[model samples]
Target: MNHEFMDALNEIVESKGIDKDILIDTIEQALLTAYKKNFGQAQNVEVEFNRESGDIKVYSTRQVVDESDYYDSFLEIELTEARKIDPAYEIGDIIRNEVTPRDFGRIAAQTAKQVVVQRLREAEREIVYNEFIEKESELVDGEISRATPNVVYVDLGRIEGIMTRNEKIAGEIYKEGQRIKVYVVEVRKTSKGPQIIVSRSHPGLVKRLFELEVPEIEQGIVQIKSIAREAGSRTKMAVKSIDEKIDPIGACVGQKGIRVKHIVDELGDEKIDIIKYSDDPAEFISEALSPSKVVKVEVNEEEKSALVVVPDYQLSLAIGKDGQNARLAAKLTNWKIDIKSESQYEEELANGTLYAKEEKIEEEIVEDFEADEAVDLEEVAEFEAEFAENEEIEE
Candidate 1:
C-alpha cells in the first residue's frame, strides 16, 4: 500500500508538473486536518510528511505537571515525576507524543487522500492557466476532431478549442482529422476547462497567415497596407513593399500562383486580389477596383471622395456582382467611390453638374467678381462727377 501511494504521488508530480516539496507541505496540512477530525480538536498537534519516503507523522503536545493528573498524551506530570522520566525536567514544559501511521484508521486515510487529489487538481489548473494566459492572440495549428453544423471542435494538443459558425469563413468547409491553422481570438477559463476561441474569418487571420507564408512579409520587406474581405467569397488586400527590389504583389503571388494558391486553398478557393499599394489615392483606388481598366479618377480630398470612370463595357465588371466589389474597394481605399461609365462621366462633365443644379461654376464666380469691381468703379466715378459739378457751380 505504501509503495502504491508513493508511486501515485510521483506520477502526479511528474504529470502535473507540480513541485514535490509543495506537495509534501500540502500533504502535511491534509494529514493535520484528518488527525484533528478523527482524534480530538483541543490537542496541540503538528504534522509532517517526507516527500522522498511518503512517511506521515503526527505529534501531540502537552504541558507537564503532577502525576495525579496523568492523561493520554496530555499528562500533567508533577515535578518529581518529570524528573524521574528526565533528570533535568522543568515545570510547564511541552512534551510531544508521536503518533504512528497505525494510529490513523481507514476513515482518516480516505479523508486525507481526497484532500490530496483535490489540491493536486487545483494546482495543475493554475499551472495550465499561467502557461496559456499570455498566448491569447497568437496563431495555432489544430486538427479538426469533430464537426457540427454550428461549431467545429479542434484538438490543440493539451486542449480542444472551438470555432463557432460566425467565426468561420462563409461557405468554408471542414472535415474531421484535417489539420488547419487558426487564430486564437480569445482564451478563457471555464468550469469544464480552458475554452479557446479560434477563428477563420477574422481579418487578422489572413494577416497572420500571410506573415507565416510570405517570407517578405515576415522579414518586414512587404507590409499589408489594408485588407477588405468578404469571407469565403472574395478578399482584396493592398500591400506595400518597403524595398524597391521586392514587388509586394509578386511576392504575395509567388511563382505561377503558388503563394496565393496556398492561401486560396486554405480559404476554400476564395478569390483574393493582391494589389500593390500606392500613396496616390487615384492610383490606389484604380488598383483596388481591378480587372477593369480605369480611364480617370477625380479625387475630392476634403470629403475623402473619388469618381472613377471606366469604359461603358467595363462598368458592370468594375461595379462587380451586387456592388460588392465597389463597396469593398471603397472600404479598402478609405474613399467614397462613385464609379461611372466613361460616356456617362463625360456627359455629366459637359453638362457641368454639381451635387445639385448644373451651372458653369467658373462663369458664375467671374460674374460675381466683375460685378463687385464695377460697383467700386461706379462709386469712384460718382465722387469725381459730384466734385466737378461743385467746381462748375462755384465758377
Candidate 2:
C-alpha cells in the first residue's frame, strides 16, 4: 500500500505541477477528516506525513488532571497515570501521544485523492487567471473553437475566451475554426474561472488595429486623437503628428492608401475616413465632414459648438446616408455640429438672426479684452507713481 501511494503521489506531483510540500499538507488534512468520519467521533488528533517513506502518524493530545477529575478519555488523563507513562509529564503541558488508526491506509488514500483533485483544479484556475489579467484591453488573435447563436468561444492557448453578440461586429459572420483578431475587453475572475470578455466592435479595436498596422503609430511618431466607428459599416479617425517632418495622414494612408486598405479589409470592407486632427475647431469640424467642400465654419467657443455651411449641392454628401457622416463627425470632434447649406445659411443671415447672434458674441469678447486692458493700465500707473514718490523721499 505504501509503494502504491508513493507512486500515485509522484504521478500527481509531476502531472499536476503541484508542490510536494503542499501535497503532503493536503494529504495530512484529508487523513484527519477521514479518521474523524470513520471513527465516529471528534477527537483532538493531528496527522503527520513523512514524504521520504510515505509514512503516516496520528497523535492525540490531552490535558493532565487529578484522578477524580478524569471524565473524558479523549480530552483529559489522570495525573498519576500520566506520571507513570512519562515521569516528566506536567499538569498543563500539551502532551502528544501517537494513536495511529488501525487499517487506515485505504480510507486515508481515498480521502486524499478527493482533496488532491479539488486542490489541483483550484490551482489551475489561479494560474490561468494570473496569466490573463495582464492582457486586459489588449488585442490578441485566436481561432474560433465553438459557437452558438449568441456566443462564440475562441481558443486562446491555455484558456478559452468568449465573445458575446453585442461585442461582435454587426453583419459579420463567425465560423468554427476561423481565426480572427479580437480585443480583450475585460478579464474577470469568477467562480468557474477566468472569464475573458473579448470584442470586435469597440472603438478601441480600431485604434489598436491601426497601432499594429502603422509603424508610425506604433513608434509614437503619429498619435490617433479620436475614433468614431459604426462597426462593419464605416469609421472616422483623427490623427496628428508630434514631429513636423512626418505627415500623419500620409503615413497612415500609406502609398496609394495601402495601409488603410489592410485595416478596411480586416473590418470586412468597412469604409474609413482618415482625417487630419486640428486644434482649431473651425478647421477640425470642416476636416471631419470630409468628401464635401465647406463654404464656412462659425464656432461658438463658450458652447463648444460649430455651424458648418456647405454648398447646397454638397449638403447631401456632407450629411451622407441617414446623416451618418455628420453624426460620426460630431462624435469624433465631441462638438455639437449644425450643418447647413449655403441657401439655408443665407436665409438665417437675411433674417438677422445668425448675424445678430454673431455680433453679440463678438461684442462680449471685445468687452472682456478691453476691461482686462484697462485694469492692467491702472496697476501700471499706480506702480510708477509709487516709485517716483519713493525716489523723492530717498533724496
Tens digits of lDDT, candidate 1, 1-395? 26677889789778877887777777677778777777777457787665566566777766776666666545455668667778877878876678645757464457658867887767766766665677677778899999999999999887788999998988777999999988888888887656789888877788887888899999999999999988888889999999999989999999997988888888889889889899999999999999778999999999899989999999999999999899889989999999999888878778766343314666788789878754777788999999999999999
Candidate 2, residue 363: Cα displacement in angstroms equals: 21
Model 1 root-mean-square deviation: 14.6
Top candidate when judged by lDDT against the true structure: 2
Off by over 4 Å in 1: 1-11, 14-16, 31-46, 57-108, 115-139, 295-312, 334-353, 356-395
Off by over 4 Å in 2: 1-19, 65-72, 352-395
Clashing pairs in 1: 65-76, 65-77, 65-78, 66-77, 66-78, 67-78
lDDT of 2 at 288: 97
Q: How accurate is candidate 2 locally (lDDT)?
A: 0.89
Query: Which 10-residue window of candidate 2 scores lowest in summed lDDT?
Result: 369-378
